[model samples]
Target chain A: MTFTINAEISQFQGKLYKLSHESTSTKTPMDVNVFVPPSSNSKIPVLVYLSGLTCTPNNATEKSFLQYFATKYGFAVVFPDTSPRGAKIEGEDDSWDFGTGAGFYVDATTDPWSKNYNMYSYVHDELPKALAKEFLQLDFENISITGHSMGGFGALSGFLKNPGKYRSVSAFAPISNPSTCQWGEKNFTNYLGNNKEDWYKYDPTHLIADYKHENQPKILIHQGSKDGFYYKDHQLQPEIFVKAAEESGYKGGVDLRVAEGYDHSYFFISSFIEDHAKHHAKYLGLIE
Target chain B: MTFTINAEISQFQGKLYKLSHESTSTKTPMDVNVFVPPSSNSKIPVLVYLSGLTCTPNNATEKSFLQYFATKYGFAVVFPDTSPRGAKIEGEDDSWDFGTGAGFYVDATTDPWSKNYNMYSYVHDELPKALAKEFLQLDFENISITGHSMGGFGALSGFLKNPGKYRSVSAFAPISNPSTCQWGEKNFTNYLGNNKEDWYKYDPTHLIADYKHENQPKILIHQGSKDGFYYKDHQLQPEIFVKAAEESGYKGGVDLRVAEGYDHSYFFISSFIEDHAKHHAKYLGLIE
Candidate 1:
């Protein structure tokens, strides 16, 4: 994990830094942006944000609605690019919903992609190592993950499969049952081989279908009723996951909020970002 | 006037529409975004927002910190592009600080640009005509103008010269004395041709020096002390205008606020946009 600090600026008493690194998981170069709260007296909780398709690290880190709440609550934020760059590997820059900008946050096992597309390991393993060593003297025990759209899938799959890694988890219109959704089905077949069992490890409902957490961390989910993808084979059908959690005795740590007349747009996110920030702040004990 | 709607979306209980039309003054086509409040009952106060150089109606309408405040206060907002487009005129789009997006809100009188670069007339006359015909129910009598950077120059110049057009005027780091600034000097020389007297109509400081308003509307200005251009050769020097106003026994209708350690960026504007919006709201009696 060799890294270098690209740039740093003081904002609202906190310091935001741009970082670049050479990763072993992705086997390519990557860029990330981080914001550390001014309260340096103690270790702070961390939140990793994953952006949706056709987005780079800049989208969430630059235009995100999380910084205000993060600054107030004294939590740190880590934003990594969706996929590796400069490699120009086969089919990296293909479709808007797949390839380069859309890594789907999964470790690619298929040929041509498996070479440099391993976002799961980059985010789960390499990213934590770099952030923990370089940025904050933060409590790794209280870190959480949250995201939107494809990033939402990343949050659910990342935290559910690696339960002990993240203390809590939440998402803004995530892909709950990816195996059944068009986006999930396409990416899964390409990244995780044809075996159905391999796909279960990355689906939140499947991971929680037979497991129960005695001390389950709080989980929050927001879905937009007017989202275009809700109909047909979309990833966000909260009922499936809710029934699974109930039948499996998942201990009721989940909160699902549906916003009416909202679409898949930044306007929708900005409207309720304050609420999401407050949710993370309260759970992290950064604010009352 | 023939008119067409570009893009529209429902928001804040009203409709926001982007409109386009051919202009009599500017000759070239012009585009503007107008947001009508949630009421069809009575005409509401209008707030015209002029954007800076290198900006179109799109920048302020999409990215500015005004929409939330306008929605909260129940006021209409109209944003006009800084200059005429598709002129195919020479010397346009030459510099970052001048031409194309930098109309300086003045009707050109010289060269190939003189034919289609009449921004002053387009904004003050043609734009108003289109608005009256299209938005017949809007309260034109309670109109106010506010802007930033070059558009600030436009706001101050337009309101002061027109006398009774706007009930209130304000700016965010406007180029106050454009006649004495490099940006103004160069553009005026090219657009108006060596006639200093003709340039007076387009300079806010010059207008204030010659005219006095007994019941002048309140003018508010927010400038960042750390702004790189404040003290530079071509800058909006607030102290000079303050001295002139004091000498003229002007009852301080203009309020100048200098924020410490801030720069000339959207961050600074977003920090204090609510205050400006409230100021206009107070004058319009939209909110108590």
Candidate 2:
């Protein structure tokens, strides 16, 4: 998986490298942006950020205000595209939420989607391996994972499913119980062949209920109080995951903070990015 | 001069208000975004930002990273659109560099353009007056001005032409000697006719040559060393303006800092936004 440097932009005391590489899992060319902090002599810790729906690598790279924090903590941040591009499947570009830009971080079991919608294995398995082999300056072993919305679900599920793979995990307005949410129900049914059992494997609440951490693993989450998805539709049932965690082996490990007056936008993510960066920095050992 | 609130977003400790208003100067509806700091009992000082060509109010509002600084300094930042929209001129929107987004902050004196290209008066006079009347909390009287590229030229010319209007002025990769540059020459010829005297009135170098600042006026500027415009094309000759200031009435007033390995993109602006914010904060009396 040889990566091509699309652009190397000077941002803060670092360089934002936009890279594209052919993926084995999705069997398509994937675009990812990595921000490498300046004045680094050795391999640095990495933070993989999965973006939400309808986003390319450029959305979070431009709006998340993560470069400042990445430079401050000497950590590299990788922003992967939400889904595969130019895949001319029958219903790929049908809707904004269903196919294109909505990979849902799942290895699809169904026919049409199974061919290309392997984002879970792509992001968790193929991407890190490719990045580690390509960029020698990034320490993929000491990495933290985070995301927003559907990508938030990706981070939580990825961290939970592959324990000990990521040192720390956090999310911004993640869909906690994807098995029950409308967005999850639609994508899972299409991607996983309407199998509830397969959907539960990817749900954060169900995964956390069975999985246990050796050192009482802590997961950080921030949900906006005024988020339209949280309040108006009640699709993101964060409290359900909190309740499930409290009753399971991962009891008292979830730290869910509801920020006041923030909506589901990058404006909300940027305001609280400092805290999230510090949280990851502490676990990544960049800060005491 | 009636204003309509397009959107109000909470960012950091301020509210970013996207507004559209009918402009008397341009005789068109203009879009502007204002970030007002939180918990201000009295009117707060304003920092007006003029964007470069090919930018609307949304560019800086989303990418400039100025809201954090606005909240930190307790000052309101105003981002005004670069040019009038949907005017339907013969050659408007023909080229990205010339027509629709390239008002050049000048009130056109020619036949076709004179009908709507009145950005100078719109930004300097009409916008502030309307904002003051509508939002009584913004102290337009005590304001600072800054911009990037062509907008940088706008800030310098606007400040120099109207003495005592702005408390401080700064620019990033500004087209300083607009009369001598291709971009400046083209816009000046179209907006103000081919009169060299009219072009001189809007040129920062010529304006600063004669105008005497009362309080040892310090104009801060940051030009990227690797900026393609500055190095390759030699279009943004910032040094000429520096030399002009050194020999003119504004001697010792211009502080032009050349940043190493930076480009003329928002990445450069976001990198040094904190310093620019602090500079404006000092002159706005928000910080010592």
Candidate 3:
């Protein structure tokens, strides 16, 4: 469970560490970035940011500006890789949206991917426990999760599935209804197989409505109105998930905002990441 | 010249334009990124960011938080390429520090490079004039200049040479005393035909003392203590420039800040970029 420190970069008023460690969930070496803000006495709260398809941990760490506000509000941000690299499975690197960078954060029950593509358990279980063992300054109990695109769907699905695990969750242009969209159907059919039951468990639109928890989970979502993937390709269906959350005992808990002229790029994430940071800050008890 | 619009991405309620145009100075197809902040009534002020060695316009455009502050302060940001690309001269792509990406922002008097490497004229005169001709909403008269590493030296030299051209000047880990440094000696000898006198004209440490302007040039510079390139290699001689500036009647104008635990990466640049942005914004009349 010992993680290797690849590089430690000083950012904002804190330190960003790039770590590589063997994972139990995925059965492969995983790379992750953790940024700890400058705090003197108290243990820092945590924020987990999952990236979209064709992205590693470096994407959000460099461009998202999450660390900027994290340093301001006092929290540690953990950026986990999208998928296990160097898996070397056939057709793994075939499609940009299907395999390789696109793990879809699902524990595959299907073929060759099943051996190494357990990003769901890796992100939620192994990674968190391993990180807790390494960083003593981090308070895992006061952690919030947020991500963009596929990772956004991952955040919502993870939040809904594991009630009380995360303090709060938010997303930027997440694939809300994955079971129906082009990206979702392709990924779910391939990763989870033909079983619609397994797909339903990982889908935010389905999970939010079918949540077994008595307490409704709160969520924050930002959708770029000018996003091509969302509008033209219909890749991101944030409206579907928002409606589901509203109908399923979460009428006022979901904060879905549509930013005009903004796209699905990190520019959109960096623009409104301050709002998401503040939202988590309130939940993590960093500010009153 | 009629510039080809490569990309126009929406960021922070503004637009980042990726433009390509044939440069008159360099005689090559040059690429530059211009960021325009959301403006309603008045024309926007501009900041020309010169990037370090082995960098295109993309490095600063992606990593540096210049745009974050540019959007906040209601100022435009122009990111110019380091050197002319695909200039198939002999040994042009051989060395990382000499040819290709490392133009050192100098107008070369030497043979092969003399034909294409005229970054001095390109950055100081041509780019601004071209940008002004293209962007009608930008107030070119209110433009300031700034850069990092080699680009820092370029910024200081450019600011010093063209008196009253730029409203303000700043740098992040600039090669202040380039004539004395290894990087400067190699570049100057190669580009300026071994003339030490020509080297002095471009050296910030030399130029600050010999500046002909009656009005003292105020400058802001940030240096990282942990930067091995600065401390170990002695590439950035900021203290030497500071001494020269003080001795030559620009006593209180030079603000050289040394940040602790910071490195030479954009992490260091993004950390204190807000201060630089505020400095330029004040001179640009965006804030009181």
Compose the digit string of candidate 1's lDDT tens values, residues A186-282.
8888888889788888888898886554546667887777787775546677667767777777874578888776666555555566677777777
- A1-288: candidate 2 lDDT, tens digit per residue: 399998888899798989999888887899999999984648799999999999999999889898899998889999998888877789889888888899999898999888889999999999998989878889999999999999999999999899788988999999999898889898999999776998999999999888876634578899989899999887789999999988885843788999988889999998888888999998999999
- Which candidate leads the pack in DockQ? 3
Q: Note the residue pairs that clash in candidate 3.
A: none
Question: Model 1 clash pairs?
Answer: none
Once fitted onto the true fold, the runs of candidate 1 whose alpha carbons sit more than 4 angstroms away are A1-15, A36-46, A61-64, A69-76, A137-141, A164-168, A214-219, A231-260, B1-3, B10-15, B36-41, B132-138, B215-218, B231-236, B253-255
Off by over 4 Å in 3: A212-217
TM-score of each model, in listed order: 0.87, 0.98, 0.98
User: Candidate 3, after superposition: displacement of residue A256 in Å?
Assistant: 2.0
Q: How high is the lDDT of residue B86 in model 2?
A: 88
TM-score of the first chain alone, every candidate: 0.94, 0.97, 0.97
